[model samples]
Target: MNQPHQPSRRILLKSAAATTAALAVGTAAAPALAAPGDTATAAAAPGGFPDYRYVKTLLKPSQLTYNPTGEIIFPCIRGTAGRLSAPLGRYYLYYAPHDAPGGICLAYGDHIEGPFTEYPRNPLVANVWQPHYSVSHVSSPHVMWNESAKEMWLYFHGENTTTRLARSKDGITFTYDKVVLSTSMLPAGTTETSYARVFPYELPSKNAHFVMLFMLNNTTNHRDIHWGWSADGRNWTFDQKALVSHNDVSAVNIGGPHLLTRGGSAFVVYNKDKTSGGDLMITEVGADFTLRRHLGRFYESAAGAPDNGRSASPSFGTEGGVPYMVYESGERLQGSISVARG
Candidate 1:
């Protein structure tokens, strides 16, 4: 397989610096316009929000058994594992295995922090021609159990340009459903759509129950998180306004959205491109689903750790009343998965 393009260190640093400068200014003020239909009247808490720090490395690329030779695979650099807790105190982790035979793979463990065992039948979803008739090089699997559908739903992107959906009775095997959102669904000038986070959210006013936060890539190549709502897990209606944008956070690029709710309040966590390093930033989600306030950086690369330079692609879950985050760190392909808690 051909090597995926890697940005030079100089370019990466320059981009990070630009993002830092923009963040310095962008986050200083509140957004002038609220998301359409947002009716939030409450101000954000003045401080004392839960701050998360890196705990330890969870899984590295070398640990995946997809490659018999144990070589680090391309595109499988940083992990995007969608974690789910099952009965009997077991857990399932679904992720794209960026090996020679690239596809989505699964791992099982008895604990959240685990010596996870890769499923014997790996590559649960293969890099085959998709329903859209494009050669599929898929990654970034975000799995959720849709109580409404009574089955597991796997949302993923292929080639980092199209977002598609699939369903499974069990978490391991899946069947393609349809393209929920993609560039073709966007306005004429838009370039791509990817990195989707779908979760069950109760919209008290609209009487809806599901929300999607996804990255939108414009013609200029800037990425931002946009909001969408669904009554069921399938069909959706997107708001043109972004939940988080370059103007709001001084980020040239932003994506990797994850939502966590605790004690009747919701929090949105996402990655922002930065000069020091790309890190996760968070904000409160109001009852109306509009982002309430910027809570600043949620997690950054540890000072001298293997992931010290960059971190991105955050996934959140709770087990035993403890909140845990799984994310990718370091450069793509060389990056690994790390977990943290509040």
Candidate 2:
């Protein structure tokens, strides 16, 4: 974690940096915006959104093993893991399903990387209402341990125009307790009352009081990721600038933001839809929250997905003290999860 004032005494990186499918692979192949090592994947903007580039391949997709019977399922974007700030320990892997609207999950490991397990009491949904009794309203979850509160939290997107949340004690279980923030609470026309966040992430700077990043649809009618900080995690105020917005070639929907602290800054890894099969992109942001420069495209699909699809969340952290990424791969229709290491 970067302190508010003191700069890290490490590499001055010019600061720019799920799931399985037994499902179907989308139809179109996304343009190779930039090859694996091309730093130009990220374009520079004047003063609004900072320029960003892809880092290296984090977790590329892999199979989700059902510990009990060892059965693998489809669409394993699962859950978001790791703590947003320091003392980052608790890692929650959520299974994408509607069986339990707020059915929370727990996958605890000593280090960021672990052969994590699916705890039996795993699904921790308190009183959450599912879309269908068969479908869980909880999707694209970003779970983390809040140091200040001395507990773990589940921040996720759901049916309502708002994001829902629940708190837990043992990390694995949550009391589907509350609806922390919903779009209905925002002033009218806050970019369509329907825009909702997919995944929730923690910002590195502690100075922001309480900080979090989320995604929403804009007037331009595209999806863009944004941030919010609360003196209290429950009462957050969003940042003025759209943390991330529409791109020139892409229709602009940025979902699943994962933040990693490396070199000296926090590098964000996410996905972009270029009107074709989506490509995963990355970039680095300064301590002041300014976009730095482009990194490059980590990996491009050898094929295209049918729904013009791509998964947003990418995994990043020190696994076995060695950095590795655990992300979902392939297109939904006939895709499965795969893993990669640097």
lDDT of each: 0.61, 0.42
Q: What is residue 181's positional error in candidate 2, in angstroms?
A: 3.3
Please give the clash total of every predicted structure, in order: 5, 48
Q: Write the per-residue lDDT of candidate 1 for residues 5-40, one digit (tens) a residue.
A: 211111111233444443332211111211233332
Per-residue CA lDDT of model 2 for 1-342, tens digit only, reads: 111112212111122221111011110011112222334322322211122222222122233322322211111222223322332233444434322343333443343334555554544553244542233344545555555665666675555355666676655555565555655554444552222222233444643554565556645666666666655667666665566655622535655555544334545555665454466555566545676554545444334331124433454433222223445544442333333333
Model 2, runs deviating above 4 Å: 1-92, 98-103, 106-117, 126-136, 185-209, 218-221, 248-251, 274-277, 292-294, 302-311, 333-337
Which 10-residue window in model 1 sums to the lowest lDDT?
A: 1-10
